[model samples]
Target: MKAEKKPIVSCKGITKVFGKDELAVHALRSIDLDIIEGDFATLAGPSGSGKTTLLNMIGALDHPTSGQVLIDGQPLSGMSKSQLSDLRLNKIGFIFQAYNLVPVLSARENVEFVLRLLKVEANERRTRADAALAEVGLRGLENRRPSALSGGQQQRVAIARALVARPRIVLADEPTANLDSTTTGELVDLMYRLNQESGTTFLIGTHDPRVMEHSKRHIEMTDGQIESDIRA
Candidate 1:
């Protein structure tokens, strides 16, 4: 039998509140979850349902008002800012709906930016960046700037950038929001393939049915709490 996978992410009694007193908004209410290694999961809910807020908490982009989170067995609440930054760089990758890329940088440079920040040597960075771009099907577009690429290509570049460092987990927030139906399908398919091949855990926040369909697990939230969790 295959060895049982471990939980790569865990949350307990997570509560996130913004503001205070009368103006307070509860973004997450006592959330409890675990994402096993290599799981392809989607957090789905309508607007104001706290999907993004929960994703932010999981990605260590925001702090919860109460409770704790653990990534790769390390407690997030105990980490300092620098430690958190290091954790993000080494263990986690983030992909956003906006496809944040430097306008002046070509696709290869964009993918190499993370490696540069990690102090990777130029030669290795270039090799890894090129390999990542090719993995995402952007082999010949390495010199193209973001403006020259279509939305899907740009998103693929973002994926390449995220995967270049070989992060254990990838967090994507509404990654398909800017793409058309066909592109969205392709993007999710690519992500699924990557998860299958690389065993990279994926936790995506999206209301898109296409994204949900491609994920192996579905977690639906409402009023800052998980309403359902179904595994395919």
Candidate 2:
């Protein structure tokens, strides 16, 4: 029998509460989940369902009020701020809905920014950035700035930026919110291909049916808790 694969990300009894006393708001409620490597999963729910909050917790951007998160089996609790920053830069990739690209930088430069932070050599950074852009079908647009690209193209640049580091996991929050139906389909297809070919895990927070349909696993959240988890 094949050995069981270890999860890339695991969350145990995660709960997040904002404010205190009467003003307290519960954002997550005793959530537990395991995201195995190469899995394409989507967190689907309406606004305020805590999908984005959960994503933030998993990405190490926010801490849970209770419980713990583990990335590649390393617990996040007790880590220093710099340590958490290192973990995010080295092990995780994030794609936001707004396509947070540097307006003045070219596509390649934006993709290379993380590499620079990691202190990779100039030549290697450029090579990896170029390769990532090409992989995302932005080969010739490498020199174009975000202002010069279309919405779909800008999002592709964001994907390349997120993937250029070759992280083990990618967290995307509403990645297709700004795109048209056709563009959304194409963007999700690109992400699906990346998951299949690179074995990188994806956990997306979205309400888009298009994204849910493309994902291999569907996790629905309601009232800050997981209502259903269905795997294909």
Task: Name the top TM-score candidate.
Answer: 2
Candidate 1 local lDDT, 1-232, one digit each (tens): 9999889899999999999999999989999999999899999988999988988888898898999999988889978989999999998999999999899999999999999989999999999999999999999999999999999999999999999898989999999999999999989999999999999899999989989988899999999999999999
TM-score of each: 0.97, 0.98
lDDT of candidates 1 onward, in order: 0.93, 0.95
How large is the C-alpha RMSD of every model relative to the true structure? 0.9, 0.8
Flag clash pairs in model 1.
none
| Candidate 2, residue 128: lDDT | 98
Q: Give the best candidate by lDDT.
A: 2
Candidate 2 minimal-lDDT segment of 10 residues:
192-201
Q: Per the 3 Å backbone cut-off, how many clashing residue pairs does candidate 2 have?
A: 0
What does candidate 1 score on TM?
Answer: 0.97
Residue-pair clashes per candidate? 0, 0
Per residue, candidate 2 scores C-alpha lDDT tens digits across 84-186 of 9999999999999999999989999999999999999999999999999999999899999999999999999999999999898999999999999999999
